[model samples]
Target: MTVTVESRPTGHPGYSQTLPREPESAAIARKLVRTALAAWYLEDLVEDAETVITELVSNAVDHARLESIRVVVTRPTEKLVRFGVVDRSRNVPYMRTDSNGDNTRGRGLLLVDALTDRWGTDRYRWGKQVWGEMKCD
Candidate 1:
């Protein structure tokens, strides 16, 4: 996958990449997030951003019905960055409240909620985007 960092004349800079909807793609998505944060000089948010993107990408890989998924990292403001995953699935993700410590899965969104300042989903005509935002100093 060829990842590109984009700069807009009127808006914040962003980075985007399309990857196969597989578990391995989570690593690539983490790299993309790291690169974007580094370019924006928001290295302090790298760990949390990577975790959020990993969960988003993992959910898409497990539930989205497509061969590929798009990972987007955008700086919406000087002190805020958004991480999103776009996939061809209309089903919105919800945190699982029924999982115990013994469960090996279903804790992704819980972690996202704990780490991110805010998180939600955007529904489009073709698909949906799951996103989370973090604030930087």
Candidate 2:
């Protein structure tokens, strides 16, 4: 996967990092979300944000056949922070309901969509970015 460092916000402080596309990276992603929220304006919702980020990153790493992952945290203002993960797979993430009593899988996007204030995906040339915004106010 291609890792690119985009310019930070002109005034708002934020962070971006490249991580290996693996399940282990989920823990690191959670930490990154917690740190970003603490450093930005979403401290009150850091726990929820961390949980959402961890699930999304874990799903991407486990499902998307990508070599690397890119995570970006940006505070567009003081009320909200956006956390996103971009991978190198073209498959779009989806949320599915489990009806066969199987609880071992297929709930990441559902949890993310249910938890975040707003979330969506943007398609890239080679992959897509699944992003969510958590509100602090």
Candidate 3:
């Protein structure tokens, strides 16, 4: 649970850390995000960011079928923040084609889709990265 918060010369702060594939990692990730947002003066986007982070991290921990996961939060630009969770599972995540009424297992992407300006997956030689980006005030 050692998280590093670093600031860039461009004035955008960044945070990075790795967490074990435990159920509690999601919550810990959220806390780390809140801290980063406060320092980066992006508190207005906390709620939306919180939801997005939870879904992204949980997917990596529970579904990616990996032992541990990596989390990165960075501001590629001042007005936007991008967060990604990298997992060893190469299976890219896709939203359910049909909303099975009351099915609680597959709605993570829906929240992500509604919350972020854009979200997608990228495949790497070892695994995949699930990322979401949103604009800040």
Candidate 4:
């Protein structure tokens, strides 16, 4: 809910976007992230991070059926970037691998889980925060 545009650069490019939790919101958030961090150290990782953010936001939009999503990004250092998407969903997202090649829509988190250094979900009073971390040294 807060977007702090601080000057202290710790490789931390943070932005919080509250938007109607829809498919388009994911794309919006991705663009916002690229703009916010275009001057930071992880410019190369922006695309990957955007993809992850899109997947997380899209998941919430499609399955959670929520009204809004808030995204936050924090980079502790130049080598790591942690990001999360907050949504009004109580159900924790899980990865479902399709072995029979019959499922096409269940691989978002799987990609996130595979690409990130770590990823998890935390509970909030009205919803949950799904987060993941990427490294770019």
Candidate 5:
């Protein structure tokens, strides 16, 4: 895994890591999120951010065709932080409306929706990025 810190126009540094698209990569992504939040003194958002990243990474690992995916952590503002997973697959993620009480799968996005202030997907020519944002204050 290679981690890189880049300066964003918002004056906050964004951290990203490219990791193999495997279930184990979710742990690494969570650690990256924790480290970045610690450095920014946004520790309060750590738990939700970690959960959001894990779900995003898990979805990518299961559905994306690429061998690798990118995990991104960015502070869009002093009071908000965003977590994103970028994959080569253009398929967008959505919450399954057909999920029932006994179903174990397809609930990740529901958890993400409940935890995040807002979440959405950004489509690009190459792929799509699924992201969730939480408020710090």
Candidate 6:
């Protein structure tokens, strides 16, 4: 995946890192989210944010046939925390409800959309980013 480090105009304190696109990377992504949140003293957001991160990273590892994927964490302000997963796959992430309620899969985006205050995707020339925000206030 082509990842550019150029920061946008959000002006928030944030972090971004790339990892091999594999099942193991999901655990690493969770660890990164936990560590980053701890460093920022945003323990309140840890549980939910980690869950969201894991879902996003796992989806990338499962679907995106890329060398690597990127995870980004940022706080636009003290009241909100944002995270995104970037992958080279052009497929857009969307929430879906399965008719079979017992289905374990296909619920990743559903949980993400349900938990986050707001979530969406941003497409670039090479890929797209699935992002969500958790409100701290």
Question: What RMSD does each model have against the real structure?
Answer: 6.9, 8.7, 6.9, 6.7, 7.2, 8.7
Lowest summed-lDDT stretch of 10 residues in model 6?
Answer: 5-14
- Which runs in model 1 stand beyond 4 Å of their true positions? 1-13
- Model 5, 1-137: lDDT tens per residue? 99896532332469899999999999999999998888877778788888899999999999888899999998888677889999999988988777588978778899889899999999999999999988876
Better of 3 and 6 by TM-score: 3
lDDT of model 4 at residue 104?
74
What lDDT, from 0 to 1, does candidate 1 have? 0.88
Candidate ranking under TM-score, highest first, comes to 1, 5, 3, 6, 2, 4
How much lDDT does each candidate structure score? 0.88, 0.78, 0.84, 0.79, 0.88, 0.83
Model 5: pairs clashing at backbone N, Cα or C within 3 Å? none
Clashing pairs in 4: none
Per-residue CA lDDT of candidate 1, range 11-66, in tens? Answer: 34488999999999999999998887777667888888888999999999999999
TM-scores for the candidates = 0.89, 0.83, 0.87, 0.82, 0.88, 0.84
Indicate whether candidate 3 or candidate 4 has the larger lDDT: 3
lDDT (Cα, 0-100) at 56 in candidate 5: 93
Q: Which residue ranges in model 2 land beyond 4 Å of their true spot?
A: 1-13
Best by TM-score: 1
Candidate 5: list runs displaced more than 4 Å: 1-12
Candidate 6: C-alpha RMSD after superposition: 8.7
Shift in Å, residue 33, candidate 3: 0.7
Q: Is candidate 2 or candidate 5 better by TM-score?
A: 5
Model 6 score (lDDT):
0.83
Candidate 2, residue 54: lDDT: 88
